[model samples]
Target: MKTWLTRCLLGGLLVTSPALAQDDDAPYAYPEDEPARDEQQEAEEDAYERRRRQVDETDDFRRVSEEEGEEGDFKELAGVDDPNIGFAVELIGGALLLDSSEGNFAKTVAGLGLRATWEYGRTFNLEPLRENLWADLRWTYGSYSDGTDFIRGDTGVHYFTVAPAYELKLGKTSLGIFGQLGGGIGYQTTSITIDAAETKVNGIKPVFQYGVGLRGRPRLSNKLSLSFRVEAMGFRRGYLNDIFLGGSIGTAF
Candidate 1:
């Protein structure tokens, strides 16, 4: 977020008393030590004022300027630019293993995930671990099967979630082991069918998600760039708690 600073200039300095300014030629007029400013000087001062008005500061105290070099840096960091910081339109698929929670008996669900990232490696320009830092935005949806249809007739454990994640690789290689930590809102649903009647219950609750795996990105062309990760993850919320073993395919720009 941006916080604009209001400029409060002293108008009295520019708008002198009419009696003094108009009576300059009269007796006991004010003595001017500095020469009258030329048109060029006035224009320069006006330009300076305009430039001052163009500066805006961000929440992290980063200064944003009208200059393209600096402006682009800030915009990309804010994830406002079209070609975000990293991967875009990445499609991921994985498997979720449901836990032994009461009132709901479901396990081994197939899930799909979408991940987009705003990497900070360029914005911050730090060395060593720079390549591993990014702002992760992910959404996951799944179609899972209910473990046993005999006890609860037919049961379904399904969910869709959105989370902000943090990921970092262990080493600086195209194929490196990485770990991710994320938490966000998950709208989980539990469906049960007894005889011929079907009933579902769902709620929006906080999710606990984490994953670790090996990923590879060989640095291909922007349009053809591809990356993948195979991970063992744990997903949990108010409705269900389970571990996930999955892999993902991502395209980077």
Candidate 2:
């Protein structure tokens, strides 16, 4: 019995001893070493995440830069449109009426004139009242001659005016009618032979002007247009006033 007990105890001890030997043969790690290993793994993961974010940011920046570059290229390829501005030359024929304290000094004086204009294409569309508004700067020079029993005189007038103009369409066609009203200053010189004596008078005066006209482009071209205008102008100073009626032929550009 003693031998059998001893054999059983020895068999159990051998089995347990192999497990202890296996545990000893396996690698041993300290508590501090475990924390270091975990920290190294975490650091590697954080580095990988940072590199991934950097790559994503770089891709996004490249995409935005490419889009902006394409937009700039398109804008460069497309050109801006032209604004409306033009030049005009005109020839005018008119009648001048002069009045002084002596009633009507000259009943009618025939005149010829020339005009140069810079048409500015900006308008204040006072809607319902008017549209197709236009403005212009005009320089005009005119000469008149009168030969009557009462008065014999030659007069020259020069004016620089700012005209606010408006247009009304006659129809759907290219032909349109226009009107202009202007007020500014002018210079006038009169040489008269009264009682066979030559007298010269020269001065500056305030001028008011108005016009109604037809304007249209020719059938062959739109770059050029023909214009016909009937204009009336008046000058006033003290008790002296001069009135003129005129017609004009002009080219528009």
Instruction: Compare the candidates by TM-score and give the number of the best one.
Output: 1
lDDT of 1 by residue, 1-253 (tens): 1232222234554566655355545555356754587999899999998777665334224543323464454232333332424555567787767776665555666777777765555465444434566545777776554435543533344444443334555455667676767777766667776655677776677787776777666667544456777878777786567777888887766
The C-alpha RMSD in Å for every predicted model, in order, reads 24.1, 17.8
Best by lDDT: 2
**lDDT accuracy of residue 141 in candidate 2:** 64
Model 1, position 82: C-alpha lDDT score: 29
What is the lDDT of every predicted structure here? 0.61, 0.64
lDDT of 2 at 166: 69
lDDT, candidate 2, 199-234, per-residue tens: 999988777767666655333344566655665666
Supply every candidate's count of residue pairs whose N, Cα or C atoms clash at under 3 angstroms.
0, 0
Which residue runs does candidate 2 get wrong by more than 4 Å?
1-85, 122-131, 139-154, 192-199, 219-222, 232-241
Cα lDDT for residue 136, model 1?
58
